[model samples]
Target: MNEALQLLKKYWNHDNFRGLQAEIIDSVVSQKDTFAQLPTGGGKSICYQIPALLQDGITLVISPLVSLIKDQVENLQKKEIKAIGLTGGISSDEVSNLLDNCLYGNYKLLYLSPERLQSDWILERLKNLPIHLIAVDEAHCISQWGNDFRPAYLKIANLKTHFPKVPILALTASATPRVKKDILEILKIENAVVFEKSFDRDNIAYMVFEVEDKLFRMVQILRKNPEPSIVYVRNRKSCIEISRQLQQSGISATYYHGGLSSNEKNKNMTLWTSEKVQVIVATNAFGMGIDKGNVKTVIHIQLPDSMESYYQEAGRCGRNGQKAFAVLLNSASDYIQAESQFLAVLPDKEFLTKVYKKLNSYFQIGYGEGIDESFTFNVNEFCAQYQFPTLKTFNAIQFLDRQGIVTLSHEFSQKIIVQFLISSKEVIRYMSLNPQQEETIVTILRNYPGIYEIPAHLNLVLISKKANSTQEAVLQILEQLQKKEIISYRANGNDSTIIFNEVREDERTINRVSKFLLIQNDLKTKQLESVLKYVSTKNECKSRLILNYFGEQKKENCGICSYCITLKSKATPAIAVSKQIISALEDTSLDSRSLEKITGQPSDQVIFALQELLEYKVIEILSNNQYRLRK
Candidate 1:
């Protein structure tokens, strides 16, 4: 234990561990099937990484997010610890080399996405490696009820059969009691040591404000707290608008969404992580698997679909144990709009069938022709080509993925530009001749290490930014050096994998499949509604409510939620007014426009207040946008 602690301090620059990290580490070292329910920023990675180093063989980490695998593997490598990742964006040769390293090298960790488990070759390769432990990140994904549920994760249980002696560690930030049970059953982890930390962050100030004009409210928030922050919205278009607003306000800001190319996403992420950009306006897809520790705030301009997602995204703030803020700016229309959007995206059978056929056709596979081939997909292109709307199309694809009809890989690809362009021999000779620029040349060589591998067709934006040079300047140098036969550079692009099942089985045998997908979509919608409930609830400690939802019992009021704070501020007559409003509605069916006249409150305030009441079930919604009291 002391030896591990020393390594922790020596490599991670931490003298003391946070939360239940040390305890979790002990469980892993003891070779127990451990379950860790740590909140975001609780240092979950170290729990397994440390024990993996102490064990005699490599620790196999199964993760759903490829971005997370890249992050963990890179962080480990930076600490001088050997680790490798088998994810998308690599060639078969690379996978072969990585597997060889895992077998022959003293690598402590081998990170792989759960989707890779379907590959028989991968399974066969793993059987020969000396794997000591299996760590499943985002363990909640194994459960059908989880917010980020993935069918591929369910197959991970078969690992026990392959490596019976290896202990398994399941970890997640959020999971309901049902999800917890499902995870244990699906992973077949018996006699597991479970350790969960309190889901409270004293340093994070949570606030929600009522806004009529969302853009105006966002401007105010950015003007007031202009530190490193994230602004989350529902659509890709909003990502652009919000970012433009921030830039107009003189804040260094950028936007990220699925619509952007992988190079753009990586550049934006890099700027945000390096503090080069003060704000990032992005969709929910931007934050998962991100590990930036200095983010001072996270603002939700639009609501997320599930409490699990909101909690995870909001938890990104204050990771460094410093004071931070998370705010939700919402209006009456925002709620209605979000709900309607959710309903609109529910796929019909026709739509699903069309997409299934289109997917097979998209990959040039006829009926059963596309059984196992994987290809990169662009949602916008697919939608445009097939005339499918974005939201419904995305929903349909997600349904297919959940039903094991396909596998989707989400990854960001970037372009690399060379700092000093020169040929191998000429560059060596130039360095040999010009000792003055030798250090600069060497740094450039080390940074653009892959220049020799794929010289042409590379994205030079990132490398240009890293080199502190203009893209043209970097290119000019590369061209000159290449002309001198010292080096070479080029441009390239690649797509993310979204693989489809090729076999067109008999419809009768697979009737359960489409029904199962429909059920999954409905449940996902419900999860999003639950998320809305958490954000809008004013009757319980927000943190405690979140913890309880994640299977944690014995948790008390956080004393920091809006409910507790409002109690301290004294319950105002607003409650009484709300009660009277509910009563009046029960007596007579009325719209907000009519209710406002009787309530004598302004339209926007009355509408906002009424929506809150409706969400709390204080008033039951009736026909034609009318409302009635529950009693």
Candidate 2:
């Protein structure tokens, strides 16, 4: 324990562990199977990383997100700790070399995706390594009841059979009681020491505003706070739209989504994290492993699909234990749109079967064929060929992936490979003829070996730095070389991979997964309803509601939430008026005059309550100036 504490201070510059981190580390170091439910920003990585440093052998980390693996590996490397991340698109030679390094290179950690466990060769190689601990990040995904369940996680239980002497540490930020029990069962962790941290974040103040002009409200909130913040939207298009709007209002802001290249994402993230930009307007793709501790606000311009996602995202703020805010700006139309969108994407089983057949046909795979085969997928091209809606097509593909019929890798930017077509002699002659392009060509040749023999991945940023040029200049030179027939360049883009897990059988496969689909849909509906209830309930503490939903009971009301604040401000009459309006609208539609008369409240109070109901989507206005319960 003393050695672990010394390493913690040496590597992370922290004198002690936070919350249950020290205890979790002790459990792992004592060779106990442990289940840890830490809240977001609870330093879950430290719990395993410290033990990995103190132990005798390599620690295997099973992560679900590629970005997370990359982020952690980079951070560890910055501390001069030996670590590596393995994912798809690597050559077989590279995998062999990486595994060899794990065995002989004295590496402290090896991070890999869950999907990689399907490779028998990799599993055979792992069996030879001396693994001290096996850590599963995002362990909640192993449960079917979890919000982000992945079928591939089921394979993790077999690790015990391979590494019989290794202890396991399972960590997650958010898991319900059912999901917690499922994790224990699926991981086969008997006699495990479970460590659960409190879900309440007292430094964070939750607020939900029912606003007509969401954008306007967002701007107002930004102006009031004017600190480092994050604004989340629903889609990539809105990410750009809201960012531009904020920029136009004289705020330094940028947008980020999964569609952008790796360089672009890193640049935007750097700008925001370094305080060069005041805000980052992004989709939910941002903020997985980001470690910015001074983020003062996180505002959601749109409602998320589930409370689990919402809680995780909102918890990204207030990591420094300062007073931070998580605000939601919503309208009645937004609620309706969210519900309708959910329904629209959930295709029927028949439609799912049709999609399955079409997918196999698109890939030119015969029945009972294509098991373990991978294909490059172009979703737009596939949709165009089938004349299918893009969203529906994507949903069907995701559903199939969840059912283990296929494996769809997340969209990662492809590598840029360049190979010189001309020989070394020809390259020397061309460079002498074109003095301007000589430096870049020479730099590329020197930095990347085998450029003349085979295509090699190149980093444009590194090339430009070595050549004393800009990235644009490097690209221009590469294009010039391509035109002059001096090289072959493949620019980076979105090229995803899909692996077929079984033979193509449309109806049989669909029927087998139909019950799972129904269960998924029901779970989604219930999750959305829970979110709606959280936003609509006016009498309870917002923090209490979120904690209770996660099965935490006996929690006191957080005095700083929007509801508590309103209560303290003596707004009891308004609450009574809103409840009366909701109860009266349950029977039938009524005009404002009739509602006011029925509730026996003043006209001003009735109008206020009606507006609140409409904004919260508890009621809707009909064409005849009548209000009724929203369907």
What do the candidate models score in CA lDDT, each in turn? 0.75, 0.86
Candidate 2 lands at a TM-score of 0.80
- Candidate 1: segments with Cα more than 4 A from true spot: 78-80, 88-100, 250-252, 258-267, 270-277, 292-294, 348-350, 371-376, 402-405, 410-497, 500-512, 552-559, 570-631
Model 2 spans with C-alpha error above 4 angstroms: 77-80, 84-86, 89-97, 119-124, 162-164, 363-376, 402-514, 571-631
Q: What is the lDDT of residue 208 in candidate 2?
A: 83
Report the backbone clash tally of model 2: 0
Write model 2 residue lDDT over 20-133, tens digit each, in one string: 998999999999999999988888999999999998889999987766888899999999999989865555689899999999999999998787787788899999888999
Shift in Å, residue 277, candidate 1: 4.5
Error of 1 at 165 (Å): 2.2
Which 10 consecutive residues of model 1 have the lowest summed lDDT? 412-421
Please estimate how well model 1 matches the true structure, expressed as its whole-model Cα lDDT: 0.75
Candidate 1 per-residue C-alpha lDDT over 59-158 given as tens digits, one digit per residue, 9 for 90 to 100: 9999877667877788788988999998644555788788998899988899987767877888999999999999999998898787667777888999
